[model samples]
Each structure stands twice: as structure tokens, then as C-alpha cells.
Target: MIHFNQVSVVYADARTPALDGVDLTVPEGELCLLVGPSGAGKSTLLGAVSGLVPHFTGGTLHGTVTVDGRDTRTHRPRELADLVGTVGQDPLAHFVTDTVEDELAYGMESLGIAPDTMRRRVEETLDLLGLADLRHRPLSTLSGGQQQRVAIGSVLTPHPKVLVLDEPTSALDPAAAEEVLSVLQRLVHDLGTTVLLAEHRLERVVQYADTVVLLPGRGRPPVIGSPAEVMAVSPVHPPVVGLGRAAGWSPLPLSVRDARRRASELRARLVGEPPASRAAEAAEPVAEPVATVTSLGVLRGTVPALDGVTLGLSRGEVVALMGRNGAGKSTLLRTLVGLHKPTSGRVTVGGVVPHRTPATELTRRVGLVPQDPRDLLYATTVRGECANADVDAGAAPGTCRDLVLRLLPGIDDDVHPRDLSEGQRLVLALAVVLTARPPLLLLDEPTRGLDYAAKARLVTVVRELAEQGHTTVLATHDVELAAELADRVVILADGEVVADGPTADVVTSSPAFAPQVAKVLHPQPWLTVHQVERALGAAS
Candidate 1:
């Protein structure tokens, strides 16, 4: 029901069109995925459907974008609000009401929907989004995932025919991401609604998508086809496809279930045991395990944040802490550094209790990179910021400057930290943390809002640090990142340790935690593209 005919969009100050000579169409009741690396103009397409392209985000537009037979050039966002519901990446940005119930009913009330209908729709939406328990809670009290569902529920309650979501699962943990994706799946199946979503994490959601719209890259045609069809050949692919590629499988699998059925025959034909490359590589770690937590219980204000938490950190190891939102993953990390004084826990780094030590001493031993490094950055320039870092960070002015320029080549020495793109700013903020050269580093969602190239830059930099003997512990929902960088895996759920072990062990345990390659293995858990390659290479 939406069509873009040779659509080209240019922002008010832009030199080139955001969408250049693009022609696309989506039929009614279709759930289409808009996948690409960041800044691939997926958002531009969503804007046209929601009438935000020409109306809200003012820009010079060319060609026709027709939605439901009405030209978007003529229709404003409000005029099409009844036809489309738009949920953005930043859930906190879209909230219009203070309370959950009021937010759900806000749209219907604006559309002059009757009181009874509004109430019914609100109740139905709360039930559908599984927000009934939190119906009376204030919007501010909800977590990022909860707020996101509420945002979707508010729009869906109005009975919009289509939903346009930008990075819906970016901020969620595995379980929460699945919860939202499941709700979307149900909406499409039961309600016959259209879905167009743009996201960086494709492995988790691509299987559910009926159609895939691979955006034109820096220089390429946008590929459109069935999920399997496009995924089989797309350059921007889930790691499982890489496994399928290396394995030379026919009609590649989108999920483990499909891969398992096909892989058994292949496994039977395989020869001897694979080389112990990964195990050998792991054994060579030069740095010692200075921190170890055994049978630890993490508690926060009467609620168990981490129950029976146990893990050890080797100086050269990069362990990815994985779990869904409200899973107590972040709590476990904070407790490690004594940010949240655990009621019943022991975190020791080099035989020194983490929480019992002075806050200043903790900085000397462990460095934390918060989710929004913005909270930590206050200086006016790249030069001034690092100078102000806590001395334990070991950040002298020269050391910080060199670190900044090396990580982000184009980062202006004089530009305000806030002016940089999300990824650039993160790297710059991290530069400040690195100057101190602490032995243990903790990062919380370090890759949010980054473009594809930028993410690679970060992974490379972090890998270098790990190679140099820094214990890196990053808390993130990015499974691919986890698979690519982490040496170990731990999963937290509702302030309790549900899974902990080597990357393969934990991933194998949680189906939701499995990466694309492991999906090919079906029952076996493989967390990264490298692991898939090794499995296929060994099997070959």
C-alpha cells in the first residue's frame, strides 16, 4: 500500500539526496524488513511512509511517494497518523504522555475515538504488548525495552494499518528483544498489519521477516527478495550465511532448525576431529587471571540482581556478558566495580575486594565505559576532556591526544565532543578511559548508534587492547559483537546467573543467544562467524 517512484530526498542543507533515484513498493498486510548498514537511507524510506520525510523533517523532495493512493508530498504526518504508527530508535524521544495508560489512549483521544473504544483499545494493546502489569506505572519508570513496547502499543492501539519501527531491538537484551519481535510477529499474523523495520542486528529478526529490502550500500543496488533468497547472496549478511557460504551448502538455511536438517548428512561425510586451534590459542594468554568470583550472590535493595554469580577474568581475556533487559547483566557488571554495593557478593581483583576498596583505588584497577559516555564527557575540546580524567586512568594531556587521534582520525581537536557522531563520540570518550591503562576494562553497550565501518574500527581497537593484556568485560546486547570479540560468555536473567561458561557453552545453552552460524548448527551453539568457519573448514 506504499509506493516510492524514483524517489529522491535532500535535506535542507544537504548537497546530495538521502535517497537517490530509488523506486520501491510494499503491498498491504506485508511485513517487510529494511536492512542495511547505518545511514543507508532506511530511515528516509520510513519517513516517507509516516509522512515525516516532507512534513516533520523538512527537506527538498523530488518524485512521488504514494501511500494508500494519496501522495505523501501532500499529506502531513498528522493527516496520516491514522494510517501509520511510527516507533523510533530512541524510545525516550517519542513519549508524549506521563503515564502508560494515558500514553496508550493519547492517539485515540486525538482522533476523536469514543471513550469506550479508547478504553477497549488501551486494554487490548496493554494485553497484546504484555504491559498490563505496568499499566499504572509512569513512563519514566520503565526500562528501555518496556518503553519501546509501550511506544508500539500506543500506536497499535489506534489501529494503524502499518507500523514503521527504526532499530526496535537495539537497546534490548536477548529475551526482551525476542519478546518485542514475537509481539511484532503476532501483530503481523493475527492483525494482518504491515511492518517496515530498520535495524543493525539482523540475525535475530530476519527469520521472521517475509520480505527483505537490502538498501543500496555506499555503491550498490538495493536487493529485494524472500528472506532466504536475499540473505544467500547479500554482502551485508548474518554470520550463518558466511558459514553456509564456506560450507558450500545448497539453498542455505536462515535458522538452525533448517540448517540441522541439512547438516546431518554433511557431518556424516566429514573426516577426523578438527584441529584444537581455538583451545591452543586460548592457552597462550600471557597475562594471569587476577580476578575471580566464585559462588557470588549479587543483591540490590531486597531484589536478587545476580544469584550465584561466578566468573573469572584473565588479564588478556575479553569476556562478553550477555542477557536480556532486566536480566541483571548490568547489575553484575556494576557490582564488579562496586558501583552498586552488592548486599551479598564478593568481587576480588588481584585478591583485593572491589567494593571494599576506595572508589579512587577502584579506578586504578578497573575502568568503566558507561552506555552513554556523554555522561562522563564534559570538557569543551578533545584536548581538555582527557586531561580531566581521573588520575587512575593515567591520562596525561599528550597521551590522551595521541590516543584520540589514533582511534578517530578525523576527530577535530577543537570540536565539541557532543558535535561528533554517536560512534565517533564513543571512541573519543573511550580514548579518555584508555589513558589510565587500567588492567580491567568494563564497557556497557559500546556499539550503539554506530555505522558499520565505525563498529569495525571499535572492534579492531578493543582487540588490540586485549592483545596488550587488558581484561575487557563489555555488557551489550550485540550478539555478533560478542561472538566476534569475547573469549568467554555469561548470561544474567532477573538479577540471577542463568548461564555461564565458555562462549560456545553459554551460547549452546541459550537458543536466543545463538549467532547466525550456530543457527545453522541448530542444536549446537556457535556464537561467531569465525567459529562457523572453523566448523565448516574442519568438517571439509
Candidate 2:
């Protein structure tokens, strides 16, 4: 259904081609998964399928790309609208309407479909994506994950033969991610729709793929194979794969069920060795709470975003704030940064009320990297953003730049911030916030676009910050990150706190929240590959 004939793409000023000699064919009615590190050509390749490559991005396409017998070079995105549907990394950029229902119908309306057909498809999409209850909500009022589902539903309503999605489930919770993937699986199996998606969270989608395409960056040619074949050698993989590698499994497991089946002997080896006690180490006495929320209640246009939520953050601790979409996790983070004032109770950071404090004064004590990294970036070039961050944070001249290089190496200083990939843009935003070295830091979906290596660098940076007496609160759906980095996990539901405890106690107990490693080594209290590796090493 999709064919790439010796295709290569090079941006106007790019020194190297984004994609080089990428010759491959995706069979009809199959789900193809794209995997690679950041700066890879995954996004560029996806754009090529929908005719947005050279047409809209101003790149030079060296070869041919055809979708469903239509050449992308000749048929622009608008001309191929009926044959292809695309949902990019950022959902905010895809909406043409203010509300969910209107947004879903906009694509079909643009295609000149009959009103009755459009309405039927719209209703069907809302139900399929669990967006029926949110049909009336404004796009701006919805949560990040909610907006993502709406974006996907909009594309699905068009009923295109091919769907191209980039990080489609990055913002969704575990259950929501499963539902979205299941819908895609149904589209592939029942409707004969061809699905091609690039996701950094391999743990969520690897098992769902019918084929795997690995775009190893740094000018290496792409590798195509089955999920197991690709994951065995792919540098970027989920913790389950990492665990499988550590334990010398003959055939690496893509899903937790498969891994659990092969974990009997390894579990026996870990009989007496408990997982390393990160929670116990973090329980040592610490400084007073850098941020405090007492019965915090917040309303977003008549909806209770946060209700009667009381929490405390001690200095030098990392807390993972987790829950389903629209569960008030983002609201709590925003409340800490003073973006939203409490409708009822109080919020304080470093002894000062965040909402009452001046913007300049508040930034020194608390900084927030929002879900949309573009919100914090305004400068034209990467260097300019770093310079501005230094000025705003009153830090050393090279502090922010150094952080960016550490988080993602080899980023061009002169490149426009708009030209960077989603993961690259997120790294810049995080560097900008880290320059302040605030007593308390808040991150909303910090690992949204980051690959395994970049995420590892981030884990290191955050841990180093904790050692210096800084508090970090991450509102995220990345279960693996919580397992690997967080000292504590706090879960919220319906604007109220539901679960709050150590990471092992919180994540290992819930099937929906457990990481790949924990699920494989269940009943043993292991949360990460590193934990299992340590236990094995000690036993040996």
C-alpha cells in the first residue's frame, strides 16, 4: 500500500540528508512501527507519506514516495486527503475548530462529505476514542491527553485508507493508550486500514506492530524486520527488552506476558534478594516542604480540575504525579507554578504563595516546563533561547547551553527553534527551566518526545539536582520513567488524591501502572531493569 523508492530527504540548510536511501514497502492492512533515537528521520518519513515533506516543509525529495498508487510528489496533502490521514506530534497544531465534536467533523466537511455521513462518522469516532463525554468541551479547556484523542478521532473520522501517526499515545494514560492502540488494531484487522506510527514509548506499542522499522540515526540506513529481530539490536528499546537482554533470554520478549512466561528461573534466582530500596533511601530525614498545597481546589470553566487536593513536597526529593487523563495531574503542576490560582484553598512554594507572588519572584523559587514545550520558547535560534534563559534565571552564561548539550548532544546553536524535532524542542524547554535551579521544579509529561538515551540523560540531570537539595515534581504517563527515577508516586483521580506512596508500592501494586520490568518480574517487587540486574549480579 505504501512504497518508498530510494527516497532521501534533505532540508534546505541541512548538511546531511534527514533520510538516506530509504527503500521499503509497507503491505496493505498492516500496522508498521517506526523506532529510533531523537534526530532520526521518523517524523520526516511520516510527513513524506502524507505529502507534507517537500511540499509543506520546503525540503528536497530525492526519490519517489507513493501511497495507495498515488505519488506524493504530484499529490499534495490536500489532494491526498481522502487517501491519507495524519496526526502529527503536537495535537494543538491539528485542530481547526474550538470544540471536540466540531473538530472531528471538520476533516469530513473539508472533504465535501454529506452532512449525514459526516455526523455518523463523528459520533462513531467520539465513541471509539472515549471522547463522547467531552464532545462539548473547548479544545483549549481539554487536557493534553484529551486533546490527543480528539486529534486522533478527527483523523479517524475522515476514514482514510492510511493513517500516519507520530507519538500518538505519548500523552495518553496506560488504559487510554491501550484503547487507542486497540482501535488502531481494529482498523487494521477489520477495516483494512494501513497504519504507520512512530512512537518513542516502545513499551506501549511494540507488541501491537505487525512490522518494525528502525531508523538508526547518524546516516545509517534503515533496518526492517519483525519486532523481535529489530529490538534485539536496537539501541533504543523498552525496559522489558533491556531486562530480557540482561537475563540472557534466547528470544527477547516484546510483551510483558511473554517476558513473564520466561521469568520463572530468573525469579527463583532472586528469591531472597530484594530489589534495591530506593524508597527506603529516600525516606531519610530531609528539609521542610519546598512546596505545599492545602485543600487546593481549582475550576476550569465550571469543571473542577483539582478538588480538595492536599500535598507536600520536601526538598531534595523527586515525586511522580500520575493518573488518568483529566485526573488533575497537570492542574496540580500548574497550581505549583502559579499558572492557575486555586478556586478554594492555598498553594505555597518556598514559603511564598505562588499565585500571589510576582512572576519574577515566583520563578526563582519554582519553574514549570509545560506539556507544550513551545509555550516556553520564543527566541528564533537555540543559542538565543539559551542566552535568554541565562538572563531570566540570573545564572551563568553557559549554564542553560550546557544543560541542552548534556540532554541532547550535537544540537546546532544557529538552527531555528521551530525547525527542531519535537524531542529536540522539549530538550531545549527543559534546559531553559533548569537554568533557574529553582527550589521546586514541575514537569508536565517530561518524557513526551524524548527517546531512551535522551531520557537517560534527563534522569541523570534530575537526580543530580535532587542531590543539591532541589525538589522535582513530574506529572507524566511514562510508567517506566516513574519506575526508574521517582522516589515517590502520587496518583490523582477526579481531581482528588487517590494513591500516594513509594514508587514500588504505588506502581507494582497496579497492573495499569506497573512498568515492563515489574510486570515481568511480578510478586518480586522489581520496578526496573537496573534493579533486576543488580539482584542477578549479587546472586552470581
Candidate 3:
């Protein structure tokens, strides 16, 4: 259904081509997953399908890209609207209406579909995506995951033959991600729709893809094959695949269940061995709490978003806030950063109430990296953004730029902020926040768009900060990341804290939040692939 022949895209000012000499094809009624490292041109390849590459992005296309036998170079996105539906990473950017129902129907209305058919498709999409109960709610009030589902449903309502999605499940929780993937499976099997998607969280969607498209970095050619064939050599992969490779398993397993079936000897080897503990556990305790939430209760439009939640963070502590969608994780972060005022209780940072502090004073006490990094970025170039951050934080001129270089090496400073990849943009936002050197740092979803290599750099940065007597709290759904970086885990459900303890105690006990390594090596107390490898090495 989609074909690219000798495709290469070069932007106006870029010296290197985003995509270089790529030839690929996606058959009808199949789901193709595009996998690659950050800045490897996965999004550029996806844009080529709907004619957004050269038409809207103002780039030059060397080769032809066709969808349903129609050349994209000759046709604009509006001209091929009937054949393709595209949903980007940011859902709020795609919405034209206030409520969920209206947003879903806006696309059909633009296409001038028959009223009867549009109404039927709207209801069908709402049901299929599990948005029936939220049909009347405003889009801005929903959680990040719910907004993602609504964005996808809005496109699916048009009933196009080809669907293109970028990081579709990055914002969703585990169960909600499964629901979205299952819907894609049904579309491919029952309805014969062609689905092309790019995702960073490969563990969630790798098992469900019909075929995998691997884009190696450094301007290499693309590799297309089955999931197993591609994952065997793919640099970016989930923990299960890494475990399979470490143990020399043939035909690397894609899912935790398959790995568990082949893990008998591996489990026995790690029977009585305990994993290495984090440095946070052995460090000296703080004299007093850096931030404290006492009976904190926040209300969002008559709904209790945070209910009587009491927590404390000490100096040099790293805590991970985890929960399902709309379980008050983001709400709690916003409360700490003074974005949301508590309705019934109080929150104090350094013994001063966050909600009552002035904006300038609050910047010195706390900093928050929100889920959408674009909200904090407005400068045209990367260098300008870093300079603005330094001025805003009252830091040295080159402080922010130095942090940016450390977080993302080799990124062009003269490039426009809008032209950077999602991961690079996130790192830039983080560098802006770090300029203030706030005592308390909070990240809503830190690793949403980061690849493994970038994530390792962030891990090192956060760990160094913790050692330097900074308090950190990050809310995330990436279990492997939590397993690696978090000293403690705090879980919330329905606006209340359900569990809070050491990382090993909380994540290993819960199935939903456990990483793949823990799932495969059950009852062994292993949390990460690195830990398992260490245990094996020690035993040998």
C-alpha cells in the first residue's frame, strides 16, 4: 500500500540528509513498525508517506513516495486526505475542538462526509477506543494517555485506508497501550487497514507488529525483516530481547512469556543471589525533609485529583512516582511545582508553601520538566534557548549550553528548536530547567522520547545530581528506567497512595509495573538485565 523508491530528504539548511537512499514497501492490511535510534530519520520516513515531507516541511525529496499507487510529490496532504490519516506525537496540536466527541468528528466534517456515516463512525470509534464514558468531557481535562487515545480516535473516525502514527503509545500506561495495540491488530486483521507507526518504547509494541523496519544510525541503509530477525541485531531493543541475546537463545524472544518459558536454567543460576543495591541506600541521611506534602488534596473541576496524599523527600534522594492513567501522578508533580493549588491540604518546599511563593523565588527552590517540553521552549535556535534559560535562572552565560552538550552530544546549536528531534527537544528543555540548580527537581515523564544511549546520559546526570545533595522526583511509566535509577518507588491509584517503599520491594511485587527482566526471572529479585548479567557472571 505504501512504497518508497530511492528516497532521500535534505532540509533547507541541513548538510546531511535526514533520510538517505531508502527503498521500502508496506503491503496492504499489515502493520509495519519503524524502529531506530534518535535522529535516525524515523519521523522523516513516516512524514514521507502522507506527503508532509516535502510539501509542508519545505524540504527537497530526491525520490518518489507513493501511497495506493499515487505519487506523494504530485499530491499534497489535503489531496490525499481520503487515503491516509496521520497522528503526531503531540495530541493537543492536532485538536480543533474542545470536547472529545467534537474532536473526533472534526476530521470527517472537513472531508465533507455524509452526516449519517460520520455520526456512525464517531460512535464506533468512541466505543472501539474505550472513550464512550468520556465522550462528553473536554479534551484539555483528560489525562495524557486519554488525550492520546482521543487523538488516535479522531483520525480513525475518517476511516482512511492507511494510518500513520508517531509514538502512539508513549504517553499511555501499560493497559491503555495494550488496548491501542489491540485496536491496531483488529484494524489490520478484520478491516484490512494499512498501519505504519514509529515508537520509542519497543517493549510495548514490538510483539504485536506484523513486520519490523530497522533504521541503523550513521546514514546506513534500512533493514526490513520479521520481528525476531530485526531484533537480533537492532541496537535499540527491550530488556527481554537483551536477555535473550545475553543467554544465547536462538530466535530472540519478543515477549516476557516466551522468555520465561526458556528461563529455567537462568532462574536456577540466580536462585540465592541478591542484586547489587543502589548507592542511595548507603548514603548519609538528610537532617530534614527538603520537601513535604502534608495531607495534600487537589480538586480538578469537582474531581479530587489528589486526595490527602502525604509524602516527604530528603536531600540526595531519588523517588519515582508511578501509577495508571489519571492516577494523580502528574497532578502531584504539578502541585509540588506550584502549578496546582491544593484544595484541602498544604505542600511546603524548604518549609515555604509552594503555591504562595512568587515565580522568581519558586525557580530557585524547585523545577519541573513537564510531559510536553514544547510548552517551555519558545526560542528560534538551540543557542538562543540556552541563553534565555541562563538569563532566566540568573546563571553564568554558558551554564545551560554546557549542560545541553553533556546531555546531548554533537547536537547543532544553530539549528532551529522546532527542527530538533523529539528526544533532542526534551534534552534541551531539561537543560533549561537545570540552569537554576533548584534544590528539588521533578520530571513528569523524562524518558518519553529518549533512546537508550540518550537515556544512559540522563541516568548519569541524575545520579550525579543526587550525589551532590539534590532531591529528585520523577513520574514515569518506563519500568526499566525506574528499575535502573529510582531509589524508592511510590505508586498512586485513584488519587490516593497505594504503595511506597524501596524500589525492589514495590516493582517486583506488582505485575503491572514490573520490568521484563523481573517478569522473566520471577522469584529471583532481579530488576534489570544488567543485574541479571552480573549475577550470572558472579556464579560462573
Model-by-model lDDT, in order? 0.74, 0.93, 0.90
Screening candidate 2 with a backbone cut-off below 3 angstroms (N, C-alpha, C), the clashing residue pairs are none
| Native-to-model Cα distance after best TM-score fit, residue 483 in candidate 3, in Å | 1.3
Write down the RMSD of all candidates, one decimal each.
Answer: 4.2, 1.1, 1.6
Error of 3 at 260 (Å): 0.8
lDDT of 3 by residue, 392-486 (tens): 99899999999999987867889998898888899999999999999999998899888877888998998888888888898998888999999
Off by over 4 Å in 3: 279-287
Error of 1 at 51 (Å): 3.1
Error of 2 at 486 (Å): 0.8
Off by over 4 Å in 2: 279-287
Candidate number of the best TM-score? 2
Model 2 weakest 10-residue run by lDDT: 278-287
Which candidate would rank higher by TM-score, 2 or 3?
2
- The lDDT leader among the candidates is 2
TM-score per model over all chains: 0.82, 0.98, 0.97
- Minimum summed lDDT over a 10-residue window in model 1 is located at 269-278
- Tens digit of lDDT per residue, candidate 2, span 29-78? 99999999988999999999999998999989988999999999999999
Cα lDDT tens digits, model 1, 1-540, are: 878888888765443456777778888778899877555678877888898887877777789988888888898888888888998766676888999999999989889999999988888888776789879888875655678788878888888888998878777777767778888888888888888888767766788888899885453557889998888767666665666676678787776667667777545543343323334545344548858877777655545667777777887888888776657766767777877765655678756788888987877788777766786788887667866763536444478777766665656567677544455667777877887877888888877655445566777777777778878888888877876767778877765666666776667566677666555554434455565566556665
